[model samples]
Target: MGRRVHWAGIGPNPLRRRVDRAEAWFAMVLTVAVVACGPVLVWRSGETAYDRAAAAADWQRNRFVPVHAVLLQDTGDFIPVYGEDGKAKAAVQAEWTAPDGTRRVGPVIPPAPGTAGTTVLIWTDSAGNPGERPDSDPMGAAIGVGLLIALLLVAVHAGVLLGVRWWLDRRRMAAWQQEWKDVEPRWSGRR
Candidate 1:
C-alpha cells in the first residue's frame, strides 16, 4: 500500500480520516491482480491475424524499405513496394513513374510474398514482364490477447467502486457492529 499523503498543515484531511481503510486494501488487490495477470493477458502463444500484421510490420521495418514503384495502368500514378533484396538489385517489372509523366513498368522478377490485407505480388516472365504471384491462404495464426486484459481491468474498476460505496454507508456498518457488541457486551452494559 502507498503511504497516505496528508495535507501540509492539517495532518490528514477530515474526509480522508472518514474514508474507510478497507477501500485502500481493495485498490491494492485490484492493482496486484492487473500486474500479476497483465503479461498473460497481453501475450498469446498461438498465431492469429494480429500476429501476422505484427510479423509483417517487423519484417518491413527491419528487413527492407518500401520502393517507389509505378502502377502498370496506361494512366495511373505510382505507389511504393518493398524491395526484393539489397539496394544494388533492381526490381524486375517494378512499376515506377519516371521524371516524365510516363509509367515505368518492368517485370518484378522472382515473385514476392503477399502482405496482410491484400495480395500484392509480381513475377518476371522470360521476357521480363511482371505477373501476379500464386495466392494460397488457409486459417493463419496471430496475436491479440491485449483486448481480453482490457475487459478484465474494467471489471476490476467496477468492483472497486461497489466496495467503496458499501463502506461509505454508515447504517449497515453500525448495525453489524451493534450485533457484535450485543454478543460480547461491554463491562458497562447499562446502555
Candidate 2:
C-alpha cells in the first residue's frame, strides 16, 4: 500500500543525461541502505564498547581493593593525560593501611587535585600496590560510543553523496562542452 517511487531514467534530453540518471539511482539506493543500516551499526558499536568497559571493570574489581589514604607530600609527578572534564592528572605520594593492617605508601591519584594531608580514596592490589579504580559508569560508555557512531555515519554519508555528485557534475559538464563544440561554429556564423 506504500506509494510507488519513480526512479530517474536516462533520456535523449540534455537535461536528463546518463550521468544524472546514474547519480539519482545511486543516491536513492545509498540513502535507503544507510538509513536501514545506521541503527544496526550504532547498536553493534555500542555493544562492543560496553563489553570492553565491563571487562575492564570486572578485572579491576577482582584485582583491586579500595582504601582511604592521606597524602604524605606533593611529589609533583604529572602525567599528560587529561580527564573527560579536561582536568590535568597527577600522581602524589600517599600512605594507607592495607587489609592486612600494614601501612603501605605509594602513588595515589586523588579524585581531585589535592595537597599534602588531603584524605582520599585509593585502590590497591592484594600486594598493597597502588592501582586504578574499577570504572562503573555505563552512561559514559553509551555516550562515547553513540558520539563515535554518529560521527562515522555523518562522514560516510557526506563522502558518498559528495563523491557521486562531483563525478556526475563533471560528466554533465563534459557533455555540455561536447554539444557546444558542434553548435558554437554554426551559431557564430563561421560555417
Candidate 3:
C-alpha cells in the first residue's frame, strides 16, 4: 500500500510550526483571490480596448476618403520600400483628383508593386493628404487585450506567492534560531 502524502501545515500535526500554518493559510487565500479576480480584470480590459478601437474605427471611416491614383513611374525597378505590414512597396509620384475637384500630384506609396499608369486605391484625409490605413478589427484588439491581462494576472499571482513564501521562510528561520539558542545551552550544560 502507498503511504498518504502529507502537506506541511495543511492539517493538524504536532510537528507543524506557527509559520508553516500561516504560510498554508496565506497560500489558500491568495489562490481564492486570483480565482475571484482574474476574470473581472480580463473582462474590464477587453471592454476598454474594444470601446477605444471601435471609436477610432468610426472616426477614421468618417474622416478618410478613398481615391484612385495613377502611378507616374514604374516601381520594383529600384530600391524597395517596406510598409508597416512589412510588405514591399515604393513611393512614386502619382496624380489624383482631390475632393475639391482639383488635380493633385504627390509622392504616394502604393499598396502593391506596379508599373507606370497602374491605378491603385489610396486613402486621403479631408484635406487630400495621404494617410495610413485605419484599423477595422475591434474584436481582434479586444481578444489581444484580454489575453495580455490574463497573462499579467498569472504573473502577479506567482510573484505574490513567491514573496509570501520567502517571508514565511525567514520567519521560520528566526524561530528555529531562537529555539536552538535555548536548547544548546542546556545540552552543553552551560545553563
Candidate 4:
C-alpha cells in the first residue's frame, strides 16, 4: 500500500506555525480565484476584441474600393519589405483614373519587382484617395489579442502570488529572529 502524503500546514499538526497555515490558506484562495476568474476574463476580452475587429472590417469593406493602377516606373530590385499581410511589397509611382473620372498619380505599394506599364490592383476610398487594405481575418486578430491579454493576466497572478510569498517569508524570518533572541542565551548557558 502507498503512504498518503499530507500537505504542510494543513490539518491538525502541532508543529505547524500560524504563518505556515496562513500561507497555505492564502495560496489555496489565490488558486481558486485564478481558476474561477481567468477563463471568464479571457473569454469576455476575446469576444469584445472580435466584435470590434469585425465591425472595423465591415466598415473598411464598405468604404474602400479596388482600382487598377499603372506603374509608371520600374520597381528596381531592392530589399523586400513585408506588409501586415506578410507579403513582400515594393513602392513605385503609379497613375490611375478615379471613379470620379479624375486622373490621380501617387506613390503606391505593389508586389515586389513590378515592371513599368504593368497594371496592379489598389484600394482607394470612395473619393479615390489611397487607403489601406481591409482586414480580412477578425478571428485571427481576436485570438492574438486574447492570447496577449491572457499572458498578461497570468503574469499578474504570478506576481501577486510571489509577492505574497515574499511577505510571508519576511514574517517567518522576523518571528524566527525574535524567538532565537530568547532561546540563544539560554541554550548557550549565558543566562
Candidate 5:
C-alpha cells in the first residue's frame, strides 16, 4: 500500500510507512529528553563562552557588562560600586547562599550599571571576583529549556500526525485496491 508519513505535512511521494510508532513510548522518551536537554545544552555553552570572556579581562578593573544587550535604568536598579579611593571600580565580595533560596547573592559594589537584577550583568576584575560573576548560565538555561519543551511537543505531535496519516492512507489505498479488483472482474473476457 502506498502511504506517506506525516510530519509537518512533508512526505515522500509513493511513500511507505517504513517506520511505525506503535509503541509511542519512544516518542514520549524523545519528548522528555528534548524538554529536559535543550536548555542545558544551550545554557552550558553560553556560560562557557562567558567564562572565557571573563578570564580574558583583568579583575582589578571590575565593571558591569550586559551578557545580553539590555537597559539597566529601565530595570530600575541602582548599580556600580566604588572602593575607598572613591574611584568607581569593582570589588570582591563574599559568596554565599542568598535568602531567595532560588538564587545566590554576593556583595557587589553595584556599579553605574549594577543591580542584582538579571537585566544588568556584573563584571569582575580578575582580582575582584565579584559574587555576581556567577558561572550559572541562567539565560542560556531558560532558552534551552524553552527550546527543549518545544522540541518535545513537536516530536510528539509529529508521531501522532504520522500515525493518523498512515492509518488514513492505508484505508484509502485498500479501497482503491478493492475498486481495481472489482473493475478487473467486470472487464474479464471482454475483447
Candidate 6:
C-alpha cells in the first residue's frame, strides 16, 4: 500500500488508532508553537541584558579615573591580592595626585609585591576616593551567549514535554492490549 499523509482533517486519519492519532496531533502542534516563539524570546532576553550592561558601563566610565600610587607596606592578607596575570599583589598605604592636582593618601594596590615604594595603577573617582576600574566592551559577547542559553532551555523543555507524552502513550497502549484480551475470547466463543 502507498503511504498516506493526513493534514489535520483533509484525508483519512494517519495513525491506525484514535489515541495514537491524538498524541501525534498534540505533539505536532506543541513543536510548532515552541519553535515559533523561540526566536522572539531569545532576542528580547539578550536585548534586555545588553541594555542594562551598557548603562552600567556608561556610569562607571564617567566616575572613575586611573592614577599611579605607591605601596606603603606589604599586603598582609588583603583580598584580591593578585593581578590578572597571577603575580603576587600587595596593598599598602599610598599617595597619588588626583585629577585636581591635589596629593591624596589611601590604601592602594601595587604592581607587584614591594616593601614601600612600588608604583601601581589605581582607579579613583572625583574628590580622590579609591574605586574600581571603568567598564569596557559595553555589550561584549554576553548577549550572544545569553541568547544561546535561552534557546537551549526552550529545546530542553520541548523535549521533556514530548518525553512525558510518550510515556503516557505507552501506558495507554498497554491498557488497550488488556482490554482486547478480555473481549476476544467472548466474541470468538459466541461465533
TM-score against native, each model: 0.30, 0.72, 0.87, 0.80, 0.30, 0.67
* Model 1 TM-score (2 dp): 0.30
Please give the TM-score that candidate 2 achieves against the real structure.
0.72
Estimate every model's Cα lDDT from 0 to 1: 0.46, 0.79, 0.85, 0.82, 0.48, 0.72
1-191 in candidate 5: lDDT tens per residue?
Answer: 23433442224534433333432344556556756876676566656555655554434233433222123232233343555558665432323222222233444444443333334445443333333443444455555555665566677668875776587678778877999887887789543
Candidate 2 per-residue C-alpha lDDT over 45-162 given as tens digits, one digit per residue, 9 for 90 to 100: 8888888888877888989999899998753546535767687777777899986789988777787777788898888888888877777765579669977997899799989899
Q: State the local distance difference test value for candidate 2.
A: 0.79
Report the C-alpha displacement of residue 26, candidate 4, in angstroms.
0.8
Residue 101 C-alpha lDDT in model 5: 27
Candidate 3 regions exceeding 4 Å error are 1-8
Clashing pairs in 2: none
For residues 21-75, could you state the per-residue lDDT of candidate 6 as single tens digits?
6666666666677678766777777777778778888888788888888776656
- For candidate 2, the per-residue lDDT at 66 reads 90
| TM-score order of candidates, top first | 3, 4, 2, 6, 1, 5
**For residues 1-191, what per-residue lDDT tens digits would candidate 3 score against the true structure?**
12222453467676887677778788788888989988998999999999999998999988888999999988766687876778877788889987777888998888888999999988888888887767678999999999999999899989998998888888888888999999999999997
Worst 10 residues of 3 by lDDT: 1-10
lDDT (tens digit, per residue) of candidate 1 on 1-191: 12333312223445543344445555566667777876555555323446666666555444332234532332112243444434222233346433333554654432332222222333333333344342222123333335555666677677776767676666557866888788655655755
Stretches of candidate 6 exceeding 4 Å from the true structure: 1-15, 70-88, 111-119, 135-141, 148-152, 163-178, 181-191
Worst 10 residues of 1 by lDDT: 134-143
- Evaluated at residue 65, the lDDT of candidate 6 is 81
Q: Which candidate gets the maximum lDDT versus the true structure?
A: 3
Distance from true location, Cα of 91 in model 3, Å: 0.9
Q: After superposition, how far is residue 177 of candidate 4 from its true place, in Å?
A: 1.4
